[model samples]
Target chain A: MSLADLTIAEAGKQLRSGQATSVDLLEAVIERASFTEAQLHCYLTIDHEGARKAAESADRELAAGTDRGPLHGIPLALKDNFCTRGMTTTCSSQILAGYVPPYDATVVSRLRSGGAVIVGKTNLDEFAMGSSTENSAFGPTRNPWDPERVPGGSSGGSAAAVAVGSALGGFGSDTGGSIRQPASLCGVVGFKPTYGLVSRYGLVAFASSLDQIGPLARNVGDALTLFEAVAGHDPLDSTSYPGPVPEMRSDLEAGPKGIRVGVVTELSGEGYEPAVSTAMAEMLNRLAADGAELVEVSLPTFELALSCYYLIAPAEASANLARFDGVRYGLRVDGETVEEMMARTRAEGFGPEVIRRILLGTYSLSAGYYDAFYGQANRLRTKLIREIAEVHERVDVLVSPTSPTVAFELGAKTQDPLAMYLSDVCTIPADLAGTPAISVPVGLDHQGLPIGLQVMAPALGEAVMFRMARAVEERAGFTARPAMAGLPT
Target chain B: MPIEIDIAHVARLARLALTPDELDRYRSQLAVILDHAARVQAVDTTGLAPTAHPLGLSNVFRPDEVRPPLDVDEVLSQAPSARDGYFEVPPALEGA
Candidate 1:
């Protein structure tokens, strides 16, 4: 009934049919953000002036007989790591507290060109280094389901904004499940496309090999729409897929009938919470009822992913983040010499988690330990890839709980790094393999928090992945909204 | 068991200046994380080439034609200190 409740496709139809104006949609977004921002902390900044101007221009364009597709005039958010010409792009880190990019990232430019109204930028963990948003230099973004709990990270703000209706849909960079884990915790749809499927030209690098820009939206169909607008090769990013992006169709009413789904044996019931496991078991039963052929598939390499990721990601981060020295841009501290000033600036600018990662990375790449840590992780990565590829030969798509548990309290696992890392155990395997995966809200936990089912497909297999995700979305019939939406402002 | 290593030495190599208090905290934290990640060594990677990248792309080359570059003035303006459209930093090869 509410303006924010309408999916992007529905809202686009209304805009084209003269039922709702772009201004009306913009107002709905602002009102929702104002009501919930204090409790949810979903955004790092809200560009009211820019968004209002963009909405007005979109209205003018449509009235003048030019249409820009589903996102035309619809309010959408981008996670802060993406460069947005003049908008401040802080990766929830103090090092670049007020830094603004001089040029737009490839994705940002594409969305702008598509006539989407840019609402604002969302927060992320400091350089996307943590599983919990608690690692952000700014305070953690709270879950919309319950304000005391984390929304998940490093794309937590994007997930929270979408869940709470602060934005219709948003784009987030997923490196090690930054997008999906948050989407799972916040009860929304998040898709991490296969590696090389999207350009990362202006995304602040975390792990260059693993980072990907994708969509977080209300449901599977909406996620596919957003992904289509941004996916494809970009000449600016040499790592982008050199071939034409595969055609993706949006007619996704297909059920999981006759599809062979692999239930990852390593991730099923053992480490997941009872509430989460119950929902997962129920999800499998529903899939089976919908004519999906469910079979147990083992990906033993799953156990090595978490460990391998920590080393490989941090090691790459140490190098990618070295560009933030005091010389070129961002925070600078005074010292007697260049190196001292650089060191002091970094020491003062970076948060504890960032420092911990840099040290770990440096130590791994150090002369005495290169063969022991970073090198070993790379070799193991190859082995992991091969083993995962072997399993994918049998199943059309693999399924698992997106996260091991529901949204936990803000400080629940922050003190213990290992405990915090375990939250991402289910999601990291797909990231390591550079394959496509999506998280769909399957059902709710006993505490009434949302649970997500992850659908994974082989490299460049997004068509099948989206089909299965849509099937799960339809069968689960998860229509419950977070109680935060009903609370008084 | 936590393995032995010097946190201070690693910090210095990374060009990070950490206080004694921070070093003590990191020493314990890094030890635990490293010990956990050590499991990577147990993975049987025999006969497999190291995977530095998932896509396995090498030396991606673009056309030699010149393209528009970022504005120097705009980039320098965002730096902490700039002089005559150049980023200003302390003299290198001196200080720690």
Candidate 2:
């Protein structure tokens, strides 16, 4: 196989056995990325010089008996929202067009320490606001499977890059299925670790409480490898769990035999695409045939998750984003007074979706409306959490389709924000409960787009999630590559 | 349905300067979204406590010790208007 097509584990084996140098692997990926950039628009910035330098240093270290484990010299991509020292972290918004961070985010620092060579920062919805990357200030990232369709987002670029073999694995933050939904659309493995399992320090806040940094990779094993490297406590983020990080890669080969899996009854049928439902049904059957017991489970509050998320995420976002008022940093426009300047700058800087959310949030949190909107949403959230916890008592993990549909055509749902929000219907509950869930490609839709089977586990239940995900990966045998994968280097 | 005037009020509260056309557009769109979001109210959360955070964490205090901060020059470098390591902004007073 070409160097660009190697998974993290495969590339690591090659690097260790003296079969391929890091420089060679890096060059192959750079070539492929350059060739595919015109069609995919997957990245905001490609750090060619920085990656080449890092790869050379990695080669020197490997030859001199200094190794940085599996990630050493592995070419990876980061979602642009992660702060990279001296690199522009625009979050795909014009407001921070030329803004560069003086320090690296904790996840970026951790990846670098593991010797992972970051090739570029991938694009996302402006401030991670939308399910479809169409909300990106830059043009929407095209699905590699079909150029006319969107790569599901706000982590669309990261998922597209990994699917097209531009990067072995990439990092993306999941606020509400941004990572997993895109991963599902792009036929890749996207895992959102438990909320506190991965530190959120330096991730540009989009609903701080719901945001989490996770991995997008070609397979479950590669996803686990990347997850382990970044999942641990960081004192910088007070919400980070102080407990020991679980060894996700230790028991990958173990099958999901005798494991109790709950098929969330509410998530299936009606509103889900017919093809996606079929793929999900086949996956459940396969799991049942493989010695796994499937029990039908229902979280009555599941239907209310999307409604609650819109209120809570936007409310937090409005408060968190108040920091970008053009005084301390980012785009600034002159006005007669400070308030006018702040308003004018924000007017010119933010996109429609962002502004819409801000307005919605401001209204919801306003004095009189708070008790009805934001307050009620929080109460519903509590009920949802309790319902999910009750369901977990009966099943080890909950399963559903990651997204309700496959990659939808660009501009299909952009006109209707509510329709766009429906794309995350199946995946938002996990974020609401702050649980670990993974999306693994199980089959293809009639349109040839990928369908993802979502495996959700309770907080800190990544081990079970991984085992179930691995089993799905093995059974599905979904080796179909995107048509864009054939682009010549 | 949200009144058009209410949309402008919310925009002002958000510190966003929206054009009249945008105000009209958002007034209708936001009403749709708010109507959809209103579905949560029917769930009967009367006795349930609100969960601002899923983790139930509160008062996450850290040691009050001095730590190295970002360089002033580096921080100012990103500002659109910087003067003597300070962010320059519009005058607070109308004519000052």
Candidate 1 local lDDT, A381-417, one digit each (tens)? 8887887788777888999999999999989988998
Q: Give a tens-digit lDDT track for model 1, residues B1-96.
A: 667879899889888999999998998998898888978887777788888668687788777789899998888878999888778888887532
Candidate number achieving the greatest lDDT relative to the actual structure: 2
lDDT of 2 by residue, B20-79 (tens): 999989888878888888788777887999985677876776778899999999998888
TM-score of chain B of each: 0.87, 0.87
- Candidate 2 lDDT over A1-489, as tens digits, reads 679898999999999899999998999888888888888999999998999999999999999999998899999999999999988899998788878999999999999999999999999999999987888888889999999999999999999999998898999999899999999999999999988888898999999879999999999989998998898988889988878877666667778788899999999888899999999898888889888999999888898899889998999899988888898778988888999999999999999999989988888898788888888998888888888888889999999999999998999999999999999998899998899999999989878999999999988888889999999999999888886755863
The parts of candidate 2 lying over 4 Å away from their true place are B1-5
Winning model by DockQ: 1
DockQ of 1: 0.80
TM-score for each of the candidates = 0.98, 0.98
- Candidate 2 DockQ vs. native: 0.77
User: Candidate 1: where are CA atoms >4 Å away?
Assistant: A485-489
